[model samples]
Target: MRKYIGELGLIITAFIWGSGFVVTSISLDYYSAYQNMAVRFLIGGVILGLVFYKKMKHVQKGTVIKGAILGSILYLAFALQTVGLQFTTPSKNAFLTAVNVVIVPLIGWAIYKKRMDKFEVAGAVLAMLGIGFLSLKFSAELNIGDILSFLCAIVFAFHIIYTAKFVKTENPIHLTVVQLLAAAVMGFIILLFRGEAAVPIVDGAVFSLVYLGIFGTAAAFLLQTVAQKFISETKAAIILSTESFWGMVLSIAVLGEVITLKMAVGAALILLAILISETKPRFLKAMPLREKV
Candidate 1:
């Protein structure tokens, strides 16, 4: 039951992030990418801090260190993806970022000396292939954006790995608040350095930013941090990869985007990947038969 709850939390997180795609499009119309990052993180951090002030007061030094590491990695991953998007097609950028689904298990195996689970590995691979089908255009061209996006994927994989490790010893809510605040600081620093620190006051921008800050950044990440406590990092990545599927569904519903055959195939593959990872099927199990006298 706990495990299922964790999985459900991750699914909700993915859905929130998927919904972010549409809000992001709207937000970008009024705010720059850097500004969006800074504002959203700030809003999320403030909200979390206010809501969990008592917990925040008891945060440990080790938790702060772990949270800072996660915060830095999170900022770097988003920075890479945002910059990569400037040079690459959105589809390509998204597909490459989703590569984190595969990298999570590899990081565990290579760095932590953990044994690879065959079902998890297979599911990760299938999820990556599904993302490719969902977002790739088969451009057959390599560029700086592609490289950066790949690097973003690697960083995101680390974020998941470290979040799982850190949550074991630290309070998840405290960790979440600290990491969000740290990320907000980093975003602000970058904005100041770039001389783009001005905040947007437009009503639509405000609404979009607030929605992202609350649901997408704060709630989604808090849920993810809590959920990782109950599931393997690889399985978490497999489930979160469904963000792309949710994005497609929301796009179809909200933006009236036409669904394609490729989208259907990709969504199916992602579902199958989740099923495979969640239920390592055994085909050779014997069935008992009863005879009536």
Candidate 2:
């Protein structure tokens, strides 16, 4: 029962993360990507830092450095993602960005030598087809932003793998809070380089920043880290893929976006692939232990 509840928490985190696209889109109207990320991570880091400061004493020395490395990867991932939002529609960006589900396994296999079963490969092929359908606009070539979003998927995959490994080694909350701070530190350094450190001060943008900071960045990651304690990393990735589904539903229901048959088919394929990849390995046959992450 407790494990199921933990899984449910991961699903909730995905929902919150999925809805961030629309919220982030709205915020983009008033803030640049660097500015938004800089502010969001800073505020989130501080808020989480306060909540977890007492717990910090419990963290070992090397964990901070490990957290920072993971944080830098995540920072690049989110930065690319937020910047990518500028060139793509919220829904499209949501779908493309969510392709990290497929990317995660590929990265795992490449870097960590984790091998996937046949179903996982099939799922990857299905998701590739889905990406085509989701982003296939006949009228225009894929824009720079769309391309950037796709690249962000790669960065995020590494981030996920690192996070999975690090979570097992460190206190989840400590790592979460410190990583948020590290991302903020990197963003601030970027703002300083861009000479736009003050661009985030507008009163009109505070609410949006707060939402990203409090709900999207801090709350979402906290939930993800804690919930990962109860689930396998691949299973966790599969669960979070639901965020794309929530993004599509919210876009239609709230933004009045039209639902196309291509999208439906593509989404179905991707979801089915995810289901198959996660279930197939465990149920069908046991593989060598070293290949599993």
Candidate 3:
């Protein structure tokens, strides 16, 4: 039941993040990328701190250190992706970012000496292929943006792995609060350095920022931190990769984008990847079944 709850939380997180694609498009019209990062993270951290004041009081130094590490990696990943988008097509950026689904298991195996699960390895590959079909434009020549986006994937993989490690020892609520606050601080510092600290006060921009802060940053990340306690980092990465599918659905429904056959195939592959990762298939088993008397 706990495992199911964790899976459900991650699914919802993916959905919320998927919806963020639309909201982010709207917000970008009014605010610079750096400004959006600063304001949304600030709002998210403040809201979480206010709601979980008791948890805030009990935050330990060790938790703060862990949270800061995760937060820094998170900010770096986003910063890379944001800058990458400036040079590359959005589709290529999205596909490259989703490559984290494959990187997570490799990181675990390489650093922690964890054995790679066959089912998860297959799922990760399928998920990456699905994301490629869903978003990639298949450009032959690589550019700086492609390099940055791939680096973003590596950083995101580290974020997922570290979140799993930290949640095992620290309180999820406290860790989440500190993580958001740390990221918010980093965002503000960068914004100030860039002279892009001004906030947009228009109603549409304000509403979009609040939506991103509350749902995208605060709620989605809180769910991710808590859910990772019950899910392996590889499985968690595969589940979160479904965000691309959800994003396509929202684009079709909200933005009235036409769906193509390619999208249908990509969606099916993503669903199959999740199923394979969740339910370890036994087709490769060598042992024969015995008949009961």
lDDT ranking from best to worst?
Answer: 1, 3, 2
- Which sections of candidate 3 miss by over 4 Å? 284-293
Q: Which ten residues in a row have the lowest lDDT in candidate 3?
A: 284-293
Question: lDDT per residue, candidate 2, 191-258, as tens digits?
Answer: 99999888646676678789989989899888887777775555666677767667777888998999
Query: Please, what's the RMSD in Å of model 2?
Result: 3.6
Candidate 1 lDDT over residue span 1-293, tens digit each = 98999999999999999999979999999999999998999899899999999888898999899999899999999999999999999999999999999999888887788777777887899999999999999998999999999999999999999999999889999999889999999999999999998885997678999999999999999999999999999999999999999999998999899999999999989998998888876741232322121
Q: What is the model-wide C-alpha lDDT for candidate 1?
A: 0.92
What lDDT does each candidate get?
A: 0.92, 0.77, 0.91
TM-score of every model versus the real structure: 0.95, 0.83, 0.96
- 1 against 2, candidate with superior lDDT: 1
Candidate 3 residue lDDT tens string, 1-293: 98899999999999999999989999999999988887888888899999999779988999999999988988999999999999899999999999999999998887888878888888999999998889987879799999999999999999999999999999999888888889999998998899777765988689999999999999999999999999899999999999999999999998899999889889989998999888877873443422221
Residue 60 of model 3 has an lDDT of 95
> Which candidate should be chosen as best, given lDDT against the real structure?
1
lDDT for position 247 in model 1: 93
Clashes of each: 0, 0, 0
Name the lDDT value of residue 236 in candidate 1.
97
